[model samples]
Target: MNEESRTNIGTPVPDASNPEEVREQVERTRDELGRTVEALAAKADVKAQAKEKTAAAKEQASEKAALMADQLRAKAEQATQLVKDKTPDPVLEKTAQAAAHVRETATRAGQYAAERAPDPLLENAGKAASFARANRNQLLAGGALLAAFLLVRRGRGRR
Candidate 1:
């Protein structure tokens, strides 16, 4: 046997009389095919890993958005609740009652003054007129003070 034939013992001899060489060729082809399959599997695994990471990131972003929306909704609800709490039916009713009382008192005082000073030229006419003017000023000052007090009270109550 020559050197080439010795070195090519387990490979295909390319001669029809070599059954062992043909079997070795078949085994070598199987090993090469297995290696190719392993390489393809590694590429597939990398692609699958990339897809999983993308899916995870998308899921996390969606969760974060949902959480933010929920927080905003909760804040809005709290603000609405605060507004509702600050506005009361009783306070409005009291303010209206106070205004009505002031109007009724002023009207009654005007009528009393008119009845007491029926004649413009009667005795003590000047004094009565001066008293009426002073009374009106007092009523106006009292009304202004009361209104300011109510406004301050209402503002504080809201806070």
Candidate 2:
């Protein structure tokens, strides 16, 4: 409200006395209004805003992951200490023996299975190739449809 502070730094308010001045002012205002609308629209874009939020979330998650690991390590240490303090010597010995037995059994079984199933990956791949060859027409049709759908969506996105 102070006269000393008042200055015409922006577009002036239209005075209706001059018709040409009013029209010029109206046009200027429309241009400004259009720009304002465009800026607002850009700000309100949900996908862009979501992407910004997702990036912020990913950054925070990466920062928190280190903290989470430290917390888990602390918890694991506490659990181990508690177990050592509470468990009986006899029970611990039995548990260790049981774990050893399980490991031995698993190792022997794995060796037996591996002996029986040599070249598993190659065999499975051969079977897969045979199945695909048998169903080539259906697979090709499905692939073409998927490709067309993706291409159409990509075209629409570019527009």
Candidate 3:
């Protein structure tokens, strides 16, 4: 490697015969160098790259968790259906009777309480019961979700 050749490795060598051509070449070289520096700086930014990777990983994990929850819900529904299908007709009838009895007992208890409780407390309890009746489906779904979460946590603890 001769000294001149080594020194001129990257430096632009424009035509000295035309000042205009030399100026254009220098401008082109400067633009190219600016682009190169920007690319190198992006590559060297470790924090930015790590942040990008973390965001992608978090998105992927969220998607996977959602998919898993959907699968678990489907499986639980299937299990419930299977159990219902396998239960005897007489057992189902007996269960329904027991549920009816429980409802009757609860109603009797509520009436007794309403007779003895303060008017304001009774009014509040009536409102709460009305709300419970109005939002039964939502309340049941929330309770089921809480139960499922507890069951899963318990199962993990056992493991």
Candidate 4:
């Protein structure tokens, strides 16, 4: 081989006057561009896989949260029903009846004390009855006033 030909052996030598060589070069460039596009497509596929994993994680978290909310709602409903079912209604009624009986007995004792005593003993008894009546009225009025004050304070606090 001649020295110049040997030096140019592997170098691209476009035949500027030949349309076929230009077409061949264009075809080779197109193949290289296709390889670059394929590499970019591979990178895009990896990014899409990451996005899909993130979306799946979000969907799973949302499903778990909804399931937890449903369980909490069911437990709250069960607790409310249990409270309603367990109340002691018969015991409350008996307690009310016993309180009424005690009131009646006290009234009878007061009436008997007024009726059976002598005049001198009756005067002392009358004074005691008057004091008892005044004390009862004061206690009732104080209790009512305290209840009203507490109710008013509670109402204001809620607001």
Predicted candidate 2 versus true structure: per-residue lDDT over 13-121, tens digit per residue: 5666899998998898899999999999989899999999999999999989999999987886665566555655655565556556866996687577656776976
lDDT of 1 by residue, 97-128 (tens): 78679679977876786677667644465577
After superposition, the stretches of candidate 4 with alpha carbons farther than 4 Å from their true spots are 1-44, 90-159
Question: Against the true structure, whose TM-score is highest?
Answer: 3
Q: Compared with the true structure, what per-residue lDDT tens digits does model 3 show for residues 1-159?
A: 986687578775666899998899889889999999999999999999999999999999999999999998788667666555665565556555655686699799999998899999999998999998886545544544454556568879998
Error of 2 at 156 (Å): 71
Model 3: ten consecutive residues of lowest lDDT = 137-146
What is the lDDT of every predicted structure here? 0.70, 0.70, 0.77, 0.70
What is the alpha-carbon lDDT for the whole of candidate 3?
0.77
Worst 10 residues of 1 by lDDT: 137-146
Q: Provide the lowest-lDDT 10-residue window in model 4.
A: 137-146
Tell me how far the alpha carbon of residue 114 in candidate 2 is from the true structure, in angstroms, after superposition: 1.7
Off by over 4 Å in 1: 1-44, 88-159
Q: With candidate 3 superimposed using the best TM-score fit, by how many Å does residue 92's alpha carbon deviate from the native? A: 1.6
lDDT tens per residue, model 4, 1-159: 886687566547677799899899879879988999999897889888899899999999999999999998788666545533553455335445655686799789868976886689878877886896666634433434444456568879999
**Where does candidate 3 clash, by residue pair?**
none
Error of 3 at 15 (Å): 3.7
Q: Which candidate is the best by lDDT?
A: 3
